[model samples]
Target: MSLSPILDLAGLTLEVNHLARGVRFYSQVLGLELARHDEAAGVAEFVVNPHQTLTLWQPITRQANDERLAPLRPRGASHLHYAWQVEPSDLEPSKGLLDAHGLEWQEINLGTEDRPDWTLYFFDPFGHGLELRGVDRADARQPHFAPTPVQRPPHALPVMGLREVALAFSDYPTMKERLPRAYGFALAKEQEDRDFAQFTLGPHPEPDGNGTPRRWLYAWDPQVGLADMLGGDHALVRFYADVDAVGALVVAAGLPCLRDDHGLAVRDPEGHVFEFIAG
Candidate 1:
């Protein structure tokens, strides 16, 4: 079957408590290249690749004059989850690097379900959950046996291309009802609540050329309770032309901005937390 024209995974923007410290870690350790830094706006971008980007801004200290952070129980993290591609051979070496850095992670074995065999899950210095998976398999019944030679490429954190965002939510059903009402998203697909639910948001036609629009999924996290305290209790996926586009959306929505930590801030519809911003 043809695939739908899914939303391009454009990258994620996060708030940092210390700008210099944050930059130092991601650059020196992860080898990410800085594309831009605007001290005036207190914003910086790490090029993840040609299309993907990671933006970091100063943290919010004073209570927001605009909106408040979503009011939910702390899930003991500030991690924004993202998945990356890896090769079978590189897995061991990559894990070594993670170990050297004292990063903790879990191994998720696919067992020949998808083309990829193993996926390594870990958290960044800032606690963002990241997954790197082998692009190919090594099983006897699978395609290849020999490990492919690979080379490390220069890292770029550009604006991420069309991709999906796994947003954390406190209530799946409430999100299912309130998200569609507050934003312009039509439900595309859903899975049983495994502590979360995935819902499609946005407009991009499917690959069949039948004009079935592309959309994004909102993955709910029941462990997260700060939807109100974080200001954006609910998360929705959509495309923005740039940072300006992000501002425009907030204003247009008529949602009150409870807090602004420069690039990362909280806006409210009572229970939604809009944290990830991209162009």
Candidate 2:
């Protein structure tokens, strides 16, 4: 079989209670440029990088007669966990900004003692868990993990792009098997206890060197590690992939999937929605 049709993570959407407050927190506080905001649609999009976007969506209550807007309306998840890639030099400035806004944050080292990669963990106004990851590029595990430089204004945070997005499942065993079997994701790393795993999609620059994939998805059992505190109900994740090829694999695997002219969407056992769009 060929490698997974998934190219990379295209975008992430968070469900927010207030669209205006969400816009202020992401734009004024985090320094992300508000690319577009549609009040009628109750959606706001922020450009994370050239290929990636972060969106905040306020779900509207559907009326009994509003069947036409059902397919067009998207639902978002709350209290989800996601991370952004930042330069090492921006770590202190990030703290300053978070402090200035009176937001409480915690600093931790996710890397080794000799080569430490610091991460700041904090919550948005809506209780969504967010991370600012300053990685050490010299780490031997990911030699090919080079992020493109993003030109930002003076007030903007030094965010390069998204590093990873995590999802917690009630049935970890099924997710462990189904994601790889249906999506062509390669197992990159896993915990000794088998409660958490990291799956990688897309190809690497050097197929023979280091063996690190371009993008990652972190999956874990509910109530394990950070998922215990940050996991939300029914979050939606979107990716850039070959929709037709992925849809074929999902059908061949006997899993339920929805297909249309735009893209393919599938739901896991835990109700997490995975939407694949053609790149």
Candidate 3:
């Protein structure tokens, strides 16, 4: 049964091998602010956005051996990559900034060879693939695809109005009891045989906002056990950007196109993957 109402998704949380390094990389490179840090606990939370948090912590020693770091190993392969969007104009300057920092980057064509929109790609310190894109493309020749909406909820809604997540959990009962209370997420619905459930994104319906509620799914599986639920070691951090901003940031980052068919992928120093998409 549902125990409490839905709360905002505060951000993604990840336990890293090196806390200090992660903090430095995110702050200096990505421009995330350090919301808070507990020196005694060695836990820090970076506010990626109003709704998103990048959490970092480290144990006395990491359990994963050198063998676990094998590039193509399946033991802990992350199937998904996150996409971060930037403004179109910001692409150039962003690439410049990245190049100054000694990071490699590239440009991308979103549509088919005959018709394509240029995009940018780079990696974070954790090997997470990140993309910066524009809200709309200028090339009339490029295939026309509708733009994804900007995902910001009203402030008046419930605890920050965070709605979407793809968490991996094991027990349904424990999650039913705990998640809603902690994250301000409500039980929009659930799917039993599919091994997952869903929560509404954004705040509860309010009088002024026109946006409809969106539902996000969370898949529970043995691979994503309870202990490994919150920080599954495999996560994608999404960044939002408009068309002009996408170009500015891309150029500043000095990145390159990933491939012809897909967005670019790069490795951060720690090896986590992030993919970028338009907001």
The candidate maximizing TM-score is 2
Structural RMSD, model 3: 17.5
TM-score of each: 0.58, 0.84, 0.42
Q: Please identify model 1 stretches exceeding 4 Å from their true place.
A: 1-6, 38-42, 60-77, 87-90, 110-117, 134-164, 180-189, 193-195, 200-218, 224-279
Which structure is stronger by lDDT: 1 or 2? 2
**lDDT for each candidate structure:** 0.46, 0.71, 0.42
Candidate 3, which segments miss by more than 4 Å at Cα?
A: 1-10, 60-80, 113-115, 136-279
Q: Candidate 2, which segments miss by more than 4 Å at Cα? A: 63-74, 136-146, 204-213, 227-229
Which candidate leads in lDDT?
2
State the lDDT of candidate 3 residue by residue for 9-102, as single tens digits.
3344454556688787766766666887665455677765444556564443333321222231112223222334344555667677777668
Clashes of each: 63, 0, 74
Candidate 1 residue-wise lDDT, 1-279, digit = tens: 222222244556555566677787677546667887765445677766554566775544443312334342111124555455444466667776777667776776645454335656766566555665454333322211122222333332111122335666555566666554443334555645454444443342222111112224445554532212111223322233233444545556675543244343334443434543343
Which is the winner by TM-score between candidate 1 and candidate 3? Answer: 1
